[model samples]
Target: MAPAVVVIDSGENQEFEGKITVYVIVCVILAAFGGLMFGYDVGISERKHVLKNNYCKYKNQSLQLFTSCLYLAALIASFIASKVCSKAGRKHTMQTASNFSLLGVVLTSAGVNLEMIIFGRIFLGFGIGFAIQAVPLFLSEIAPARIRGALNITICETPTSLIERNKMEKGVKVLRKIRGVENVDNEFDSIVHACEMARQVKDPFRKLMKPVSRPPLVIAICLQVFQQFTGINAIMFYAPVLFLTVGFGNDAALLSSVIIGLVNVFSTMVSVYLVDRTGRRLLLLEAWEAILVVIMVCIFVMGFAWSWGPLGWLIPSETFPLETRSAGFAFAVSSNMFFTFVIAQAFLSMLCHMQAGIFFFFAAWIIIMGVFTWFLVPETKGVPVDSMLDKVWKQHWFWRTYMADDDCTTVVKVV
Candidate 1:
């Protein structure tokens, strides 16, 4: 089993709790809003202010150019998010990202023409791109790993891995003949049994103590990147566009956008409350699946009503550990922006042109994400920083059933 973490609780400490810690939590809450603000700023900024009023004077190519500039900026910034996070650390990267976003806001507010607005939107995209990578990772790291996914770094199988695992478990009778093995079932069973035994014999403590490898570190980054590819950001970045496309007038559309922020805050609180209790993998599986369903419904409701307008509730509360938390978070955050860029700039346009296909290419991707998370993602509930990987690698089934006993909860001397 992974060891538990214990924060120091000094009696009558005067440094925090009353006012100081409140500010800290408040800061964290504000920091986390980089996503929400990105949604609000970039999502609707173009529609009411720029696209509707100024772009009318432009030629066809300029309108397209005007619409696409911010996306290109986001794509570039997202590519930089991981490297920046690794080099600058999470908090600093976030502050930088926020400053850029603020700058974007100022530029947009001051813009006198399409050129200035486009420049502002580009900066906004850059700010959001950086935030998507930094903020989620920041929240994931500072918050307990047991509660990381709830804060936002959801883990899912990479589809390819899940399929192989599923085949190994379920396709024994078929795969054996292809491999020319006469005892296919036995051979496969033996492999499964062997891996299980290895997992069982692997000492959680010993594995935890081993040096971190490059592969898991890379995996953490890739997982976060995949998260962005799911296309949640497409809806977020283009909420007003999507609403306007679906026939909502300007006033209702703006209100719809604000509601998204409200819903996100409320849903995130739910993750915060339940993250420590439910495993990250499980929460991710459920949330992604739910999001996927919502996307499908949106497709069905296309041109008629906006499905689950604005406030997204897909924060998966379970996948972070102190060791590589920032790197993993950076990857995931960047990936989301990258994914959103592709969806908004490419897929949606293609589907909109097609006229029959629902702009939900990302929905299928998320469903794949759900499948991967169900099998390969490990449980990190209540696991301490040092032994977190071990608890997952060891595949301890009994862990889910175990509770923190009072006698076992004492803090060990750090020696």
Candidate 2:
């Protein structure tokens, strides 16, 4: 990193002039561990499976089960994770997730049979479910502190957020520890107001069904669906196999996949810089780059890494109101895990049957998602998470209607 762009609070609030304390950087890295856990399982499982495929009689089915099982377990976890997050706070939720991941890894690494591996994958799935469910919302909440640069600033929740959880004294103490000489009262008040409004809603999940939640929910779910359908995971999950199908030897195929994974990692880091500057929609629109589509595998990996990979999480996490953030994002995470399971389970079959046409199939989805991003998705670059309804959704021409009530006349502005 770079220093963050200064963001003045919109509407009626004082400027947030906090610097990037080391604590914030630590939080950012903490959030990143979940993603690394996810990517590692996807790639490493395939590498091992692919190496042993020659001796296996049912390679496709076994590969599918091993690779896709984690996603299925994660999908189940996503359903329950909303309540856990709502009741237990993000720190506790993440702690639970990491526990599941560690235990799952132990079982998986020590497995002696397919039964053991599949059983271990179930735990891995639960970890994935909880991790994805909490991490994005965590990032969204913390990321607002610095609109640009890396997205986070503390170990525990923000000081003002403790007020929402009825830990006002702790919140103030923690705030003082993290913040320098700058006034955090306005920011504190803003968070409290958002939490107050959220508290008034007895059922955040039920409220998620209302028109106010429709745009972000729709965007969140669709983005996850599109992200998987882009076939990035299909390639990622079966990278070595995909390389072999595309005309590489065993050693070469494995090597290429490793390179692609590295490219994916590097490009994702690039998004940390480009995201706030170029805006969410523009980064998403990078998929429509025809040149990249026709280019090399690393180029394709680079394109997806910076664009869909990061935005899929970033946009959805920041889009919801405080009341529905956890509940809504659960659906998003579930959608992603569900489709990831489907693709990871069926991709090898699809690859064998569809052959060269598989690329075209995913490419078509890429175009459709690109069009969706342009026409339907609103730009959510600089807006605070709590202000999305007023500053982002209500402002978008297509989504504005959903934010209105039955007054038929005077109401406050949305966008």
> What's the TM-score of each model vs. the native?
0.55, 0.87
In the range 1-415, model 1's lDDT, one tens digit per residue, is: 2112222122111111111123334444666676675657544544543245222232244444554566568767865775666555555667777788889889989989979988988888788777776665445333433433443422211111112234453345432322333444433443344233323423332322333322234335445445455544444444554555554557655665555544544554555445402799987786675456445434433311121111121222123332233344444444545545555455345545653344455557666766755554555455533343334433434332322333112212000
Off by over 4 Å in 1: 1-24, 49-68, 71-75, 78-89, 145-231, 239-265, 274-328, 359-363, 396-415
- RMSD of every candidate to native, in Å, equals 18.7, 8.1
**Span of 10 residues, lowest total lDDT, candidate 1:** 11-20
Report the lDDT tens digits of candidate 2 across residue range 310-335: 89988888777666778899999999
* Candidate 1 lDDT: 0.46
True lDDT of residue 142, candidate 2: 54
> Which residue runs of candidate 2 sit more than 4 Å off their true CA positions?
1-14, 52-59, 145-149, 152-154, 276-295, 405-415
